[model samples]
Target: MPRILAIDYGLKRTGIAVTDEMQIIASGLTTIPSETAITFLKDYFAKEKVERVLIGEPKQMDYTPSESAKLIEAFVEKFKNNFPDLPFERVDERFTSKMAFQTMIDSGLKKKQRQNKALIDEISATIMLQDYLSRKNF
Candidate 1:
């Protein structure tokens, strides 16, 4: 089976994650500058068989779309124009960042390591992918 890719998009940086070929495990792929996200994805698609893409959908506590949603939506439009053949979905990403930080703490990462925003973004993508897998499985 082809892998499913997940993206945690931010203003400056974007995180990427992908499922195993068997679709059993979600793993962090990389973090890249938001400006290069499309180029990075194009290269990635050339090398991997990706079945779908999942983008993190930011939301407020009351479930309203967050301010960042506008930027994400613009990005999605560009993505669709670039990869019209690839289908994509948006998954709620309310606390994935916080969760990633907690994960770092639980794993005993040093403060300096935990301060790496790129690492946090990558972990957030992984967490988002894992959450999607869990929901889909049950």
Candidate 2:
């Protein structure tokens, strides 16, 4: 089976995650600059078989779209234009950053290591992917 890719899009950086070939485990892939995310995905898809791309949909406590949603929507539009054949889905991303931080702490990461924003972003993407996997059998 092909892998399912996930993205945690931010203003400056975008975190990436992917499922195993058997689609059992979700793992952090990398964090790339938002400016270069399209190029990065293009390169990645060229080498790997991704069945779908799951983008994080940030929401507020009231379940309304967060301020960051506009930027993410713009990026999604571009992504669709760039890869028309690729499928996309949205997964609710709430408290993913905090969850990532806790995950780092639980894993015994040092203070300095925990401060790495890129690592946090990657972990956030992984958490989002894991959450999605847990909710759906797919």
Candidate 3:
């Protein structure tokens, strides 16, 4: 089976993750500017087949849509229109950023590395993909 790709999209940067061929493990790919993600993904898909997309869905503590929800919604809309054949699943992105930061600190990331919020976003994307993979799939 081909890999499943996950994306944590932000205004300034987007983090991409991918599952192994067996779809058992998820790993962070790279953090890239949002404007370039579409082109990158297009080229990637042209080279490699992707099964589905898992995106971080921004939500508030109470499970309500957060302010970032609007941007994500727009992105989703564009995604749907651009890639109608591909399916998308959403994983609530609550404290994934916080957890990412914690992971980085614990992993011994330098102060300068920690300062790059894109690193946090990449880790967050990994977390989202891992969490989704832990669940039972139909």
lDDT values, one for every candidate: 0.97, 0.95, 0.88
Tens digit per residue, CA lDDT, model 3, 1-138: 988888999998999988888989989988999878778888888988898999889988899998888888888888888889988898888899999999999999999989988888889899988888888364
lDDT of 1 at 27: 100
Count clashing residue pairs per candidate.
0, 0, 0
Stretches of candidate 2 off by over 4 Å are none
Q: Using alpha carbons, what is the TM-score of model 1? A: 0.98
Candidate 3 segments whose C-alpha is farther than 4 A from its true place: none
lDDT of 1 by residue, 40-138 (tens): 999999999999999999999999999999999999999999999999999999999999999999999999999999999999999999999898899
Candidate 2 lDDT over 46-94, as tens digits, reads 9999999999999999999999999999999999999999999999889
Query: Lowest-scoring 10 consecutive residues by lDDT in candidate 3?
Result: 129-138
TM-score: which is higher, 2 or 3? 2
* RMSD each, Å: 0.6, 1.0, 1.4
lDDT of 2: 0.95
